[model samples]
Target: MDQYSVPAGPAAGEFRDRSSKFVAALYHVQDEAAALDAVAEQARIHNRCNHHCYAYRLGPGPDRWRANDDGEPSGTAGKPILGQIDKAGLSDILIVVSRYFGGTKLGTSGLINAYREAARLALEEVTVTQQLLLTGVRLAFGYALMTPVMSALSQLGLEMADQAFGERAEVLLELPESTASATVRELQAAIAGVYVEEVGDDFEVEGLTVLVTPTGD
Candidate 1:
């Protein structure tokens, strides 16, 4: 997926029922490592809390996530949190709910509702925005063509993906797949057909199919 929504910044919310408190914090994470780190930090912060149940969506896809119920039944805490996140149509984010038992055992259903509400509340306070995914293109061109080639990229607001200089300099760049056809046309018109091609496998982002071509035959 090219674009998806993530938390604008960090946000927090809570839900209380029968004195049991479920506090949730939201964060934007790029990968599993960051998601786990956020969970660890929450655990550290709420060291004395009963459980640190969490759910994270790691990629543009829904299958790239895990829900940990912590110690509240098998599917009580984590699944509800994850369900809430998915319901909000968000990914690449983590919602960690720290629970403090108030001497009242919120049964399976209670725990589920509490966690879901907590996560939903936290998400409601966040600012959602779209993020783009970019892929690399290894563009090899004659040194002489660098001027117009660079100018074309500059005008399109495209950025270099790599930095390597040589006689026939190779410049890697990234662009959204949605503009691939137009971009290819622009580059072709500027440099002729001598160089420029897709380099890697086609990928998806922002609900667009993207492919890269290399200059080499």
Candidate 2:
């Protein structure tokens, strides 16, 4: 399956009505147990609520996951929230909706609408992108050629994660999986013809860290 992007950490939002309160929950988790734990924790924190319904997807595994409506109707709260996650094509995500009664009891349909809308609204506040396999390349260049090289790299759509200036300038770059090889080749051809230096290893880049892994390890 495709590795789509979801939020990396927990996010939350609240919606209120004259007689009901809805809290939306979203979190990124590595496994079903973790996802359930997060939901349980959130439910515990908001235990005073009338209902705590949850949905989650844990990627493809024995841990693909499940959802529960707590005490609400069987399909009202949990299923609709799960539908929102599936519609977004997002996995490794968990969402829980907590409702507090304000002297009025919303029927099953109303509960479903409130939970679904709350989940949707919370997702709208998040920025989701495709989670690409990122590769990092370090380039060292003399002062005279630095600007041109940097500009070329930028135009190639490389993410400049870090830079350090000294006798020779060093730059850390991130390239997506589809373009990593081509970008590396372009960089070598562009610099080898003009400079006398070595280009560093091609490795996976995550956030500010560059990681090197063995072929089977």
How good is model 1 by TM-score? 0.78
Residues 120-202 of candidate 2 have per-residue lDDT tens digits of: 87777666655445566666667777666766665556667788988877787766645665567666544444331344454
Residue 204's lDDT within candidate 2 is: 24
**Over all chains combined, what TM-score does candidate 2 have?**
0.58
Minimal lDDT window, size 10, model 2: 208-217
Model 2 spans > 4 angstroms off:
60-63, 132-217
Residue 189 in model 2: lDDT: 42
Inter-residue clash pairs, candidate 2: none
Which segments of candidate 1 are over 4 A away from where they belong? Answer: 147-172, 193-217
Candidates' TM-scores?
Answer: 0.78, 0.58
Tell me how candidate 1 scores on lDDT.
0.77
Scored by lDDT, the top model is 1
Error of 2 at 83 (Å): 1.2
Q: Cα RMSD (Å) per model?
A: 6.9, 8.2
